[model samples]
Target chain A: MKARIKVTLKPGVLDPQGKAIQNALGALGFDGVNDVRQGKYIEVDVAGMSEEQARTEVERMCRDLLANTVIENYTYELAP
Target chain B: MKARIKVTLKPGVLDPQGKAIQNALGALGFDGVNDVRQGKYIEVDVAGMSEEQARTEVERMCRDLLANTVIENYTYELAP
Candidate 1:
């Protein structure tokens, strides 16, 4: 099975990389761009687990390592 | 408006960071993990554009600045 995790910054968190991208967009003439936030997406392959088990395991992985709980939120999908 | 972009490695590309994370997961005792691939997610806020326009603008941004078309693929979503 495979699990995909999307980790995003919580609302109101400062994102320096996002700000940098926004400025770069302005420099590149992409007018009207006002703000930007950057995040991470991770895909993992797991063996010997049912779909439900895989989701649970990946959720724990997100909490323990993939995401910073104090500033980020994560959601995941599991697939065979 | 807001646009969200996901940038992922093309199949067959080497991913050192993904490998590192996989090793870390194994060390942390998340068993049955076989592989890991990492990607990027970005969100941008734009003003003065219709949804269609925003998508087009972001598509161009991905092609020209945000993504390395040779090795990565990027998809984006636009929302009010």
Candidate 2:
């Protein structure tokens, strides 16, 4: 199974990197951008696991290592 | 309009960060992980624009600033 995960900063959390990107976009003459938020996209390939097992494993991975739960939120999907 | 963009390293490109994550998962006793790849997810809020215009603008942003193009590929979707 393959797991695709996205870890994003929770609402109201500061994101300096996103801010920098927004500013850089403005400087590059691209207008109309009001806000920007950046996050992480991770893909993991798991061997010898059923979909249910992969889901459980990936959820644990997120809680244990993939995310900083205090300020970030994570969501994932699994595919064969 | 809102644009959700994902920027990822092209296949065949080495990803040291992903390797480290895989190793860490193993160290944490999480097994069965065969491979891991990391990427970027970005959300942009555009003011006063139709979806078509937002798409065009965002495509340029991806090409010019959000993605390296040489090593990274980007895909995006727009939402109201």
Most lDDT-accurate candidate = 2
Least accurate 10 contiguous residues by lDDT in model 2 chain B: B47-56
Could you tell me the lDDT of residue A59 within candidate 1? 86
lDDT of 1 by residue, A16-52 (tens): 9998898888999999987888999899999998888
Instruction: Give residue A15's error in model 2 in angstroms.
Output: 0.4
Root-mean-square deviation of candidate 1: 1.2
What tens digits encode model 1's per-residue C-alpha lDDT throughout B1-80? 88878999999999998999999999999999999999999988899998888878999999988999999999888778
Query: How good is model 2 by TM-score?
Result: 0.98
Candidate lDDT (C-alpha), each: 0.91, 0.96
DockQ for each candidate? 0.85, 0.93
Q: Per-residue lDDT for A77 in model 1?
A: 82
Q: Count the backbone clashes (under 3 Å) in each candidate.
A: 0, 0
